[model samples]
Target: METQNLGSSPDVRSKNESVKSVDRRNFLRSAGMTTVAGAVFLAGCDKDDDMTPTPTSVDLGSGDVGILNYAYALEQLEAAFYTQVVATPFSGITDAERSMLTDIRDHEIIHRDFLKAALGNNAIAGLEVNFSSIDFTSRASVLGAAKLFEDTGVQAYNGAGNLIKDANYLLIAGKIVSVEARHAAAIRDLLMPNSTSFAGDDIIDAKGLDKAVKPADILAAVKPYVKTTITASNLPTS
Candidate 1:
């Protein structure tokens, strides 16, 4: 329950304005778009696990709203993941594991709802997911899948930030990504006890920044889970 407010923690609440400003400005210029010299980071900071079936196939529209849809899709997947993980907990799951994952599930659901409220009608349909690939009863399988989702979700938010021109959306993305990072770390520790796989070179760079993934790449990674064809061709580039 304590981790429920992970985003509000001092580490996550603090702004990385200097780093983000340079990256965002560079991204804008590279994309041949306008620029905001010193871009300010938004800092705004929430529960429940949703396992309901949302829309199967939905278009991620375009513009800032589309980016929101992109995030919503990931949140949909994550919320479902932790929901199932908690609902049908894996064998040998520790009480600590369940508590932490339950908190994560609540965070994801809150994220999904946040995006929905933010996007309103502009939001895409709720995604229907297929979890047949995962062995819900196996701790290894569950934690592995959780790691993938959390890490990818973090990267997705990082990449999608450049596409978002709205300061409000950018701020929200920052808030969510920090929590995702927390999830990634917690799950990673569970998977490899006392190991440093949380921020391993595979995901983070030498500079210690999480890699940003393109929308196309992100859709590909989660494609097998969702039966729909995610069309992100119109999303902003760079």
Candidate 2:
């Protein structure tokens, strides 16, 4: 699992990377409170805070913080998946597929790192994933899992949008969701080349909008791929 640095090239820069140099730490420092859409995330614990992880389950905090943690968790899973995909490329993988998958792995790594940096101490622990079900040696297995993860990620962000109180956080979520959607499309295209599956009717509504799934539903859908017991009991419902 050899991932490339975010500074590999100028064109491959991500939304957060565009702020300054591609150094991950530098990006976090540059973004500190002032630049991340001007929203200062909650710092320090409080007596009224209800976010506490039990021995059995990881609790995603409430409000905007919870939403950020939720996003971070998903990115961790995707990053790990892509890392494995690129590290042990499926048999008979084409050069184009290899290149595209590698690029995707980088993007996912950036996403995971960015969220971890932004959350600082408030971020959740590194998630332990279970990819035992996926056969990395088979292109269909790998690509199918990729498609599921990407599509779920896009829907997760979209559904969490209205629950976010901070406009800055909402804006950032929008940016990330757009990237996730692109990833979803890319994976879909790879699975079914030169076809309408990229924007198929299954994911898109009659109004041409992508599906927006609730956090609980999204988590349940991805439970098979994740080993950690994540509890969102405190996450915002409205």
Candidate 3:
């Protein structure tokens, strides 16, 4: 597959100098952490439609590769969304909101780039995204979408934890998920200031745990945003 460079906003381009100055080994050591093209799914294809041509299927290989690609896919979507958010700056966006969203955008870009580098040739092709449902000019629309993506990401990492077989991969995943959880909380607070919505009953369970959605469900929910048809048939089930 051809390696596709996910385009960046001007801000991301400007920061490239500082980002490149960091020693790669040191960055990977401290971050252990953390693509675009269409949105991606772990292993399932969207429902077939007689009226539409079948979309090309990109397989996420099994084991650690599948998991990493799964994450790469989400990061790609997030980076794309936030890049647009920062570039356009929704109507009535406050300075605080702009700064916060810009930070999130940079983080997502880092995550996406890290995963791509880690996967190297194993990574799937860049995906095509569809953001038609989102009204970027509207604050409520953008923030609402941000909240959904962040929350869903937290759940995805939580649920996929058990599926990861490599100890090192699991450790890196843990680190990444913590950051994602923080993003979710921050977005929530922005949407509902001074309220219990940050850890509200909607996402928090009676056991004081966040929801851990299965791969199939997560893919289904995010399918609309992605224009590519991804196949996760090889993902670990047990």
Please give, for residues 44-134, the per-residue lDDT of candidate 2 as tens digits: 1221443555234578899899999999999999999999999999886665567677767766766777777778779887777889998
Ranking by lDDT: 2, 3, 1
TM-score of 3: 0.77
Clashing pairs in 1: none
Model 3, position 209, has a per-residue lDDT of 95
Tell me the tens digit of each residue's lDDT in model 1 across 40-73: 1110221234465665567888888788889988
TM-score of each: 0.77, 0.77, 0.77
Instruction: Look at candidate 2 and tell me the lDDT of residue 131.
Output: 98
Q: What are the runs in model 3 whose C-alpha is more than 4 Å off?
A: 1-55
Shift in Å, residue 16, candidate 2: 34
- Residue 198's C-alpha lDDT in candidate 1? 65
